[model samples]
Target: MKPMKLMKEIASDIVSLVYPHICVGCGSVMPFGGGILCAECRADFDEPVLDRCPVCGRIIYHRGKCRSCNGTRLYFDRGHSVFEYKDNVRNAVLNCKYRNMKHIGRYFGEIMADYAEKNALCGFDMVTAVPLHKNRMRQRGYNQSDIPAAMVASRLNTPCVSALERVVDTKPQNFLSREERLKNIKRAFAVRDKEAIKGKSILLIDDIYTTGATVNECAKVLKKNGASRVEFLTFSCRAED
Candidate 1:
């Protein structure tokens, strides 16, 4: 091995020894220093049940489409999520979003990639993330969704496209009611290049799905710009019991 490369590896090992990596899901020091979750935490992460709405990806008793989305005019054709937004999974998501633990996003993205492949959800032409407004991007120093979107696109051998931009800097959606969320997010996103997404099937990526307001707004803009279909893949979702 090159002497410089060996020195760098040694330096990294020294840093790891000094500051051990803690699992984002459980706050335990991972036996293996490279990953974000301990094995037990990964195993215990809550997942949604099989019976879910095909359109909204919400947990439902019966198959096909749930009554909530049956007559609703949703912009996205379908949605899929890896875990229910609760417990350790929820903590991991919060860490990824607000705590600057972006490695967790990559980890979750890999999980989403596996889920998509196993469930045959890899038919989209391109993958794009719900873009963050400039103000939010400046405050956070990164768009959390971009990490997972790029990772998923890389895993699926599809192009990751930044085809949308947040034109309006709206308030955070988590504290808002459904009606408020819909109003706040409407007309907030604009397509970057209509020709890039024209008639293409798009897989939109985001970290969480609360009321589906944010992703739906993004899908609305994408479809308006001639995207043939817009589907969503999220890390965690607010599933109804």
Candidate 2:
């Protein structure tokens, strides 16, 4: 090994011994070196049931498309998510988005990559993220979506493209009811490069999938600009029913 690299590894080990990297979920030190969650937390991380709507991937009791997507329609053909947005998964997302635990983002990204590889995200020509508005971007320092997109893109061996822009600073979806969320995000996003996304399959990445308002709007815009297909993968989603 290069002396410099070996020295760096040694230095990291020494620092780790003094201040170990702890799992955010349970506050126990991580036993392995790959991700933020400890082995037990990773094992405990529950996968959502496959009872989601085919179009939105939110849990549905006895149907394919949820009521919203069934009648209203969406540009994105389908959506998939790794875990339900509750308990440890919810806390992990909050930490990743607001608490600067970027490692958690990478961990969730790996889960998404594994899921995509095993169950096929159809034909994603490129990966992009649902953009945060400019002001939000400045406030947050980084887009949470980028971490997952980067990991999945690297694993899938496809290009990661930042092809969409949130032109308007919309309110947090958590603050709004479902009706307001739909209104707040409508027309807030715009395509940045028509040539890049035109006739290409796009996989949109985000931290959470709630009402499907944001992703649906994003998919609509992408399709309008000639994206061949739009699909999405989120870390957490609520029960569709």
Candidate 3:
């Protein structure tokens, strides 16, 4: 190797030794160029979701709606999640939300984008992220879904429209039971642009899916405002069974 090139490599190694990149999923030091998730975390996360319920997108064993959707009236036509909310995936999402690791959100966005492409989940006129209420946005400094939603839109070469707004500042859905979640999230969102939404297929992106109350409510608002079709994609889904 040339002397200058060797020196540059040495300097990079020294810099990395001083300030190593940490894996967002496991909080371990990442090898140079290993990216956000380390090898083990990647292996745990990238497995294809198998036997998922088509209606609510929860991983399931049999056909048709899973337990979460079997008895309920849903607003969104259908939805799918990239990973079930557990283990490393769960840790990463919590880190993104609580620890304010924006890069982790972006990493999930790229993962979602890749999943969309591989699964042929395109054809939406616009992509959107579930919005944060103004108060939450102020407290959190950013919507965790926004960067990933925009990245997915960029992958599809479509516009990422801010088409919905959260009108109510409800309690976090994680703390509530399914019944309570439904009550807490009811009518929480409103469409921002009926004209843009009318007759358009919308792809909504979020970080996690639990009882389906939140995204279902968003879908209800979209359809109510005349959106032709509403589908949601999330980084993880709760495996209730």
> Which candidate ranks first by TM-score, i.e. highest?
3
Number of the top lDDT candidate: 3
- Could you estimate the TM-score for every candidate? 0.86, 0.85, 0.89
TM match of model 1 to true structure: 0.86
lDDT value, residue 74 of candidate 1: 88
Please list the Cα RMSD from the true structure of every candidate, rounded to 1 decimal place: 5.5, 5.6, 7.8
| Rank list by lDDT | 3, 1, 2
User: Could you give candidate 2's per-residue lDDT for residues 1-241 as a string of tens digits?
Assistant: 8777577567645644433367766667655554566676667685436587777787778855677777776788888887788777777888778765655666788888998888877467999988988898766656888988988988888899999999989888898987899899999999998998889999999989988899999999999999999999998888765
Pairs of residues at least 3 apart in sequence or in different chains that clash in candidate 1: none
lDDT of 2 at 154: 83
The segments of candidate 2 whose C-alpha lies over 4 angstroms from its true place after superposition are 1-20, 28-35, 47-50
Minimum summed lDDT over a 10-residue window in model 3 is located at 11-20
Between candidates 1 and 3, name the one with more favorable lDDT. Answer: 3
- What is the lDDT, from 0 to 100, of the residue 91 in candidate 1? 82
Candidate 1 off by > 4 Å = 1-20, 46-48, 62-64
Reference-based lDDT, residue 142, model 2: 69
Output the better candidate (2/3) by lDDT.
3
